[model samples]
Target: MVDVFFNTWDNNRINNSRPIDTNDPTYVIVHGYQSTGGNPGNNFTPQAWMSEMAQNIRDLEGNDANILVVDWQDGANTLNYFAAADRVDEVGVEVADYLLGQGVNPANTTLIGHSLGAHIMGEAGEELRERRGEVDRLIGLDPAGPEFEGGWFSRPNSTDYRLDPSDADRVVAFHTSSTLGYDDPLADLDLYINWDDLLQPGASTFVGNHGYAHTLYNDLLDGFGFAQSNGTTLSLSTINGNTAGSVFVDTFTV
Candidate 1:
């Protein structure tokens, strides 16, 4: 089952009350495979990043903002990658159903996901578009490429199966790991971080590189700037702005 947490961002509180302020910008955050919403025992404190990102969003938009964290641990926390991948569309449909039931305004919602969760957001976005309308924005952090892009198993060649520009009004993605993460441009704007070396600075393995997407996003939320080759400093505004197409950014540190 999927566990949705409505975060209040005050003392790590979770308010699951539905029918939140629809006018306020609502964020639905989803984690990737093998991770829970806020379980530390998974050796990866995904909840820590979620909380940090939520707090950062609250700081940017004040207390009126609504933050929802989706945890599909029963389906995602598994040893079988293909099985977990197969459940993406189903879980995404459920997520869409939940959001639609809560009367969330698509124009004021932003879906953020990492790895396999990114594809979940894509499926959810597609379902929402068909049921209601498209979301305002969809942020994909190094979308998983294993089963979807011919690694473990051959996936369908349809763009509908993966994230594309049609998923939302504004689709932005960050490609961090080429091996574990999707290498192709899967959104309106794809930002390739440390593309020259593939491995981000301070990341020893491809897994570390794959996991760094959320950290980079959190850093971007914290007002950290990434520099492009042409001496352009890309910030959160750059991602949210009217920029389109792939841009390369080199990360010098963690």
Candidate 2:
């Protein structure tokens, strides 16, 4: 079943609208590491991130498009990477099954993930593709963590075995400040967006570090726009409010 964690405002407003309708595609957002509960270092509580993302999606797509923010109990632990990835796949299947039960077409659903969450999305897409058809879309936002560069981390290319070009009609991958080479494995995909080469003259060159400025968030918003417009790949500077960087978009038809 699709488990929905709505914002408190939505809960209190008590609208007559159904949280998710099968006729319309829904978005399931998965957050990155330290996004869960119980820590001062955490940017926002998992519930809060869910609420915020749901609100954003509602603002962009209105009430008809459903948004589900997932939370697993072990979301905060560092050693639970494998478990978390597995959970993402399980949750994806659950969401798809729920949508099917509600009469929603599998082709209409989309999965969006950031950082480690993106790896989770990849894993989920693979699992879902095995049972059902591919998901409508999978958006990866700067999807690499510390482990991704090292031998210990499970690379998306190696771990997510189902993101082949033949599986999905569209697969869009975006890299803002990814330390890993983002273009190699995905060059054959339908679309690839990158901004790593656009780093400012004096920008930090820390190895395996790409979390500079607010590039991550801006790239995500722009990526959403690009996906919706079916526009050509972009190579523009000035994303959000950051300067001295550029964005690139490339599309290939399979």
Candidate 3:
């Protein structure tokens, strides 16, 4: 099961009963594999980034927006990657039901997920579309590639199996690590940061590289600025249209 935590504009964690205002935008953040949600920290160092990103959205949207953090640590923190991957769709349904019960408007909601959580959000968005049509935006922060893209498991070519353009009205993704993260263009607008190599600059390991997507995204939420890619200026603040292609961001030059 997935646990969805709510946050007020004051950044205070609240219970699920607080009615969400459908007029304002809501941001839901989901963490990836082998991680728990909270502040102190977890074995996965970047797990805490969820709270930071949620708070950043809270600060950006003020009292008008709703910020949600999803905890699927029970399903995620496991030695068997395949077992954990199998739980994505189940968790996604749980999340989608929670939002539906809360009366969250899909047109005013954005689902953001990292690694395996990205695919989970994809399933959630798909569930919402099946019931309510579509969501406003869906952002995948370095979606997991191992099983979803084809490895020791059966690779699914359908959008139903992973994050894709049909998941939301506007699907966007950021790729920072090609080794652990999905490198293919799955979103309507795919942004590849430091695409030339597997390891991102300043990242000593693949894990660190995988983390850059959320960290950089958190910064982008706080107006860290934009980058020029494929002759197009890209940033979170200016996401628009069905841009069906990949944009490479050379972090060193940007």
By lDDT, the best candidate is 1
Per-residue error for 1 in candidate 3, Å, reads 4.9
lDDT by residue for model 2 over 68-108, one digit each (tens)? 55543344245766544445555545544555555555577
Best TM-score among the predictions, by candidate number: 1
Predicted structure 2: lDDT: 0.47
User: Candidate 1: where are CA atoms >4 Å away?
Assistant: 1-11, 17-19, 39-46, 151-156
What does candidate 3's lDDT look like per residue over 101-196, in tens digits? 878898889999999989999999999999986999999999998788875656654678889989999999889988888878999888888788
Rank the models by TM-score, top first. Answer: 1, 3, 2
lDDT of 1 by residue, 56-172 (tens): 887887777778877777788789987888888877888888889878888889999999989999999999999999999999999998877764456544677877889899999
C-alpha lDDT of residue 120 in model 2:
58
Better of 2 and 3 by lDDT: 3
TM-score of 3: 0.88
Q: What pairs collide in candidate 2?
A: 233-249, 234-249
